[model samples]
Target: MYRILCVASVMLAATTATGGTLDEVKTRGALNCGVNTGLVGFASKDAAGVWQGFDVGLCRAVAAAVLGDPNAVNFIETTAATRYRVLNAGEADLLARNTTWSFTTDVDLKVDFAGINYYDGQGFMVPKALGLSSARELDGRKICVQEDTTSAMNVAEYFKRYEMTYEAIPVAGTAEAQSLYLEGACEVYSSDASQLAAIRATFAAPADHVLLEDIISKEPLGPVVRHGDDDWADLVRWVLNALIAAEELGVNSANVDELKAQGTSTPEVNRLLGLEGLMGEMLGLDADWAVRAIKAGGNYGELFAKNIGETTPIGLSRGLNLQWTEGGLLYSPPFR
Candidate 1:
């Protein structure tokens, strides 16, 4: 039933989606990408004014796949409150912001999730001084959260399920929520575990905060597009799949070119690199589409490592994000 609804909406999107967002993007010479206002490891601008991160890489990869230029993207900064409005308004061609996949947004809001690029879960962070180690102990405490996000709802649901009462402090975004939490206006800060890590890593006193081990809700964050254009939707879906598939096929940015050179001998690799199958043509792209996207910023694994790996300040281990062969949930459908 869920799949049926998604397909019906996707078909509606194909006939009416964005009124030709792809064409407009082509004429405008860029893919307008909706990104977070400033999340350090997910979607933030660097010192050179270059947008670089895991989410940013996906946007750039999509741009490279479509516009033939990785840099052909205008990153529109948006908040949790405005991210959906920004995409629905056609102000952005794609939203690679760390938006979670939910049933409401998938069907009710007319947005189609491309795929789950990052499997995450909602968790809480509090100062060590609180002496509270478990989320069950958060009763009656003040929690800071961004408005218009799943984190907000998840917090409420978890509390309700626990029959616990707490003060809900709603802020405009993560930055504001963090500020209030740091300033002691709120005792708890709740968001995706990855985001909590990103927020804490940037803090001058990183050791002061502790992320509770209890994950309250699943958060499958990924790219989203307004429903209506099947061709555009198909292109986005395949582009994302291409990235994951590249990783599965061992075709990183460094070796994609070499693998392309050594063609049909490696059937699966050839199909992904767009050398053998009609995959690229099916998506209205050239044979080298996935190559350009992958080369834009290595494969999925490479992006995760550079942006927010254990070596980085965020210091997250690729636990559930590891490829399926390695006992993780990160798997791509066969490119055949």
Candidate 2:
């Protein structure tokens, strides 16, 4: 009897130690998501002080999968210089800001990028009064860019490639860059093209500004989590994969529950929605984890449409962002 009790206690302790982030999250009852201070299509708070955007939707989907409540999220607004610090310091469970997936960030920052949710490129936005038709025309001009980001490197590279000399004024965030550009402190504002469009929509005089046609560098933005936690990483990665899979399987938020009840006819959908497999269990979650996530915000395409699609003020076209079948690079691995 004594030996049995001791073995039972040892097993319990081992289970507790190996439970990973899922157990920690269940005990805390909330997910901490790091977001931008204010970027329209990525992450921003509304008049009611509620956060909503494409990246924010990803956070909500994770929360729904983990905590079963889409609103069980704590948004921590962070700047480019501080986002990685916050994640590495354990201040956030996930970083869903508009961060580019690069070799340095992935390897040196001690963080794991789950997947690329947005395929973007850096561009320049300038006032139409400048009569500039291309980025190459802006020689020796002051460009406002975000500090501690890939934008600065891309800006330097673009200028070097064109044999042009220019002054780059690094701002702390996107809002500040927009402000500096609008106040004529800088000749151009440089960032992602989609972000430029979002900022242009909020301008007091939208028609005054135009985005230059040159795309300098690739910016594949995605969610990130701390390194050395494979279970947590898998949970986040699969949640994103489920969103993409749901879109591929023709599932949306409105019909998610019905599909869940009826069960999926397709094997891929069955494995994704946890109808016939233990995929979620392998990631330390229940079988219906993907189902809960899809119910929270439909699929990736739906989330994009509702937040930053053509109908929205961002008005972005799915040029290189369409799925593999649609001739774009937005394909995901099979759920099985």
Candidate 3:
């Protein structure tokens, strides 16, 4: 009766199951990473057609860890709607897109989030001339929201709770939302705060637009992989943890070689760098995996500062993304 009653759910899980992603990726000679179609600061191609961004850094790090070559990655473009389809079909070994880990996707859809790489929040961007100080003031206005994302539902719930109404201008992706917003088709564009900052930075006259001081919903964005693959998930999870731990332990790309060559007094750093334990062998990778990963994209803070920090065009600060030592949410587990 159990099998009969839950046959549909079982079948769904079976279809999406990808258990041997590590072996598959190794056999294929490259890591197939799913990324956003075009989110400038998170994932986008540069002028020479090289993928570079915060999320792309994760992909490269994973590639370096698993395949021993950072450049051995094929970035498959996926939209908000088709990201899961591509991942489940086994076309992408991992997804480093800026996806929010929600209950529905986690429990119901059976997606596994490796870890939270970014702590984001829902926000609204409006023209500076609008002079809107809060999202509460946008009653009955047209708001551009990307379809098939948490932003849509969050915006709806927020307006309903505040007893306000607005016409939602649904868009398929960030580019469309940005275009419609710039064309004045909508008074406001609702999205993640990081994305809003990224989009605003790309505008010709960035000062013309301003993000409201409102952060309506918590969005813990992270890397995602399919369920039923604990081995692959652990590898990915530890790679992320290694980066975060590197940041906390002061093992950066600049000093990784020296640390690995001469060794460290910190036992956790030794274990993390594969100098004191069989951590990498346990993951079916060589001992130098974490070192290669950190070298590929530096530590977590380095990736952030390089891709989207205050100096970059995206100009994102390490608000909640700082290390746990500094009272932020980024705390990696002990390498031992």
Candidate 4:
């Protein structure tokens, strides 16, 4: 019995030694955000090597809210296969890669998706010269797809459901898949619809290729953190919610400061921006947490517009991602 007690005490000491991610992040003074190597609208480095995108904006917002510095983040480039490994290994405090949130990934991978930032779906892109207007037309085409992603499985299922056959040329990353497709090594590139648009924009002749209208699978892409840290997870989730709520409340980066100073009586806005309440304290942060996040980047719609919306190079329509107030599905829970 004494030996068992000694072993139990040692285990308790070890558990206490490995602090939670929130405490570790507070101690380190920065956040490690895992992102894709380069996906134009989602996450990418510019000519100056500064990371920027819709997903990167979320990382910055979280850093701003937590560390009080939007740029206080280290961007770790990771591929689909390496993303989860990096998070599980403690290399990243948050996985902001444009990863799909699925039941299998959430339950089996031991990671929690904080919230859905982007609603996307798997799609097929082919050269316009192929005269294949629909996904059903590709019966036995060679397809370039990312290995170890839902894209591969979704593409296969899509074909099988149509009683078709095809050859899958698996690539390790988006760039590789784009290269193979551009070289005519594969007749089609299968990936998220937004990714297809981004890849097409990079091609020498964007007009020569076309993404099919069919959206095969539901891909709710968002930020993820390692499981077992509920406090940290709540912080991330509410940060995203704050962005969405800000948009719903007509709050933009340009007008945030003005509105905060004016001090509106709206309970939702007050709770969100912490102008009249202590919502941030619930998340173990100051009342100005959401304000800092908004200052880091604009509201959700603004970020989407600046990065990947129809006005951007990727030229994506809001489609199902528009706010419920605007006839879409982007409504957020009330802050109050």
Winner by TM-score between candidate 3 and candidate 2: 3
Q: Write the per-residue lDDT of candidate 3 for residues 154-273, one digit (tens) a residue.
A: 999999999999999999988899999999999999999999998898899999998898999999999999878888999999999999999999999999999999999999999998
What do the candidate models score in CA lDDT, each in turn? 0.89, 0.88, 0.93, 0.90
Order of candidate numbers by lDDT, starting with the best: 3, 4, 1, 2
For candidate 3, give the lDDT of residue 23. 85
Report the lDDT of model 2 for residue 324. 83
Give, for candidate 1, the lowest lDDT window spanning 10 residues: 13-22
Give a tens-digit lDDT track for model 4, residues 1-336: 999999999888666534378788889999999998999888898899899899999999999999899999999999888999999999999999779999899999999999899899999999999998899999989999988888889988888898999999999988888888989999999999988998788788999999999999999998999877778888999999999999999888998888888878787887787887778888888989999999998899999999998988899999889999989888788887
lDDT of 3 at 33: 97
Task: Give me the displacement of residue 199 in model 4, in angstroms.
Answer: 1.2
| List of clashing residue pairs for candidate 2 | none
lDDT per residue, candidate 1, 1-336, as tens digits? 999999998888666654487777778999999999889999887899888888999999999998899999999999888888999998988899888898988988899898888999999999999998999999999999888778889999999999999999989888888889889999999999999999999899999889999999989988999877667777887888888888887889998888888775768888888778688777767889999999999898999999999999999899899999999999888878
- For lDDT, candidate 1 versus 3, the one ahead is 3
**Residue pairs clashing, model 3:** none
lDDT by residue for model 2 over 235-276, one digit each (tens)? Answer: 898899889978988988888888778986798877887888
